[model samples]
Target: MTVLFSNSRNAQRYRAAFFLSLPALIGLFLFHYWPIADTVRLSFTDYKVFTGEFTFTGLKNYDLALKDPLLLLSLKNTAVFFLIKVPLQMALGLMLAMLVAKPGRDSTLLRTLVLFPAVTSMVVASIVWGMMFHSDIGIVNSLLESLGLPQQGFLRDKHQALPVLAAITIWKDVGLSMIFYLAGLLAIPGEYYEAARIDGAGRWQLFRNITLPLLNRTHVFVLVTSTIAAFKIFVPVEVLTDGGPSNATRVIVHYIFHLAFRFNRFSYATALSVILAVLLIAISVFQLRITRDEDDD
Candidate 1:
């Protein structure tokens, strides 16, 4: 009798827990899962939000997206941004993490200072950077002129625009990567360092052998997430360059926005979005596999 009563009470507790989590589950379905499902459906149709009309177009949208020249350019630009931004961000973040890894008042202050830019609103940061990079009256140009150097167009120049935008992204987001690396660094036991030092292992040797190897998981996480962010870059391009200077900074997300809103090619935009989603998912899966293999090894 006692055992039956306990089991019944356990079942009641489980039921209560399920009920408690129901609201959040419902919210996820309504907001996230539903939108993704709808987007996939819309990608196969000629849907226009303004007209409230849609026709099933089969694979026409995908074909058109594949053939679009601007779409190809956007893809190239996104790849370039990822290649440039991720390495620089990771390197700087790792350096900052190493610098502030020790526990002290100075370290705490330095960490806070480094994290300030990451906590700032990205749109606001982009706007401030845009102003700073202005041609004639901007501070950057003024500095160059003071040094008797030729003033260069930053956002207005085709060759310099994308790289400058990538730099801004790295500056704003490096703090997040740094925090991840810091956490990884702190989690590593101090005994390892002590053991290495006793064996005459220098700082460089200790870091190269112990620190880098142990940070494998953190590196994987940062790389995958940073790659996704680079591919989804839209705000900086929109606010700073508006995909101008001969379509130099036209990233995929910005192009999707332009197609959906400006050109009213909602279906085509949805197709492009679907493709991007697939690409990110594939990259994430590949990274996960590599991480798992590393762990196994």
Candidate 2:
């Protein structure tokens, strides 16, 4: 009798716990899962958001998206941004991490200052950077003119727009990478550094052999995340360039925004979004596989 009563109490406790979590589970299904399912469904149809009318379009949207010259240009621009932004951000972040790795008052202060840009809102940063990059009445151009160099049209010039936007992104985001690298550096055992120092290993040799090798996982994480962030880049392009100067800075996400809201091509926008989702998933899986293989070795 006593054992049966205990079992009954335990069952009641479990039921209560599940009931307690039911609201969150329902919220997740309604907000997250349902939206994803709806997006996938809408991608296959000619959905008009304004009229709430859609026809079964099969692969028509995807076909048009593939052949769209603007999309092709956006893809190329996205690749270019990814290639340039990722390396520079990682390098700069690694450098800053190393500089602030040692714990001290000065190091703490420097780390705070370095990470300031990261905690700032991206939209605010983009707006601020937009003002800074202005040809006239902007600090950047003012400095150039002060040095006897002619003021140049930065975002207005097709050739310079993408590169300028990339630089702004790098500056705003590098601090996040720095924090990750700093954490990786801190987690390394002090004994390794002590042993290397006792053996008269130079700083560069110690870092190249010990620090860099140990940071392989951190490097992989930063690389993958930075690449994903670069692909989804929108604010800087939207606020600063609006994908202008002949679509020079029109990244994939920016192009999707232009298609969906600006032009009201809901189905086509969803198709492009599906493509982006697949691309990110593939990149993430490939990176994880590489990291796992390295670990196995």
Candidate 3:
């Protein structure tokens, strides 16, 4: 009788644990893993909405994506966007976190204002920025004219469009990055700072030696995530410029969307998406490995 009861209790515990994890497991399969697997499978076939049928095209889609000039241009544009946005966002986030780490006069108000952008919807933010960047009648141009500076088209000019888009992205997203940095800062032990102070370490020396070293994980997280976000950027470009001013601001995601919906190139678009996913995964793995080595030491 005792043995039977013990076995029943163990079985009940195992079932309870499984039930507890069911929701998250379902979410992972439904939202993330399953969608990725579906996309991978779709990449090999000529799947389209109107046709309602698909035929395996093997690696033809990938070959077309590779040979396409616009795809190559989109890749270059994405690289440039990542290079400009990620560092700026990280630096701005770190600065905001440091400034708001300890409340001083008006700090609460400052924090509220800074975080407002992040809470706003991205579509709304893009629309507002679009209006602001309007060449002839926009607020930005008006201010430039008032100051007697050159009144140039922010989005209409091919050379200027990507940078303006990057700036908007940084403004809208930096608040979230700031919050992450703040959380990281809070996780750090105060004893480290106190010890450094006792050792006559200045602000710069303490930040350089302790804060940066301790925040390695946060740095890696921010870099990898921000880079991925930059690479996947689509809405702002789509809404503000429609991949134009001569496709100057066209990134890979924008191209993929156009290929799938506008050009009816479903297979090619899926192939491009798979390539992007692979690139992001490779980058994340490399970053994790490097950070793990640093942590081990």
Best by lDDT: 1
TM-score, candidate 1, is 0.93
In candidate 3, which residue ranges exceed 4 Å CA deviation? Answer: 1-32, 293-297
Clashing pairs in 2: none
Candidate number with the higher TM-score (1 or 2): 2
lDDT of 3: 0.90
TM-score of each: 0.93, 0.94, 0.89
- Superposed Cα deviation of residue 276, candidate 2 (Å): 0.5
Misplaced by over 4 Å in model 2 are: 1-5
- TM-score winner, 1 or 3: 1
Model 3 residue 230 CA deviation in Å: 0.9
Ranking by TM-score: 2, 1, 3
Candidate 1: segments with Cα more than 4 A from true spot: 1-15, 294-297
lDDT of 1 at 240: 84
lDDT of 1 by residue, 1-297 (tens): 566678879889899999999999999999999999999999999986878999999999899987899989999999998989999999999999999987899999999998898889999889898888889778999999999999999999998998999999998999999999999999999999999999999989998999999999899989999989998999999888899899999989999999889998888999999999998999889978988898898
Candidate 3, residues 1-297, lDDT tens digits: the string is 566678879889889999999999999999999999989988999876786888898998898877899989999999999889999999999998988888676767777888898889889999999899999779999999999999997999999999999999999999888888988998999999999899999999999999888888789889888988998999999899988988898899999999889998887798999999898899889878887898899
lDDT at position 25, candidate 1: 100
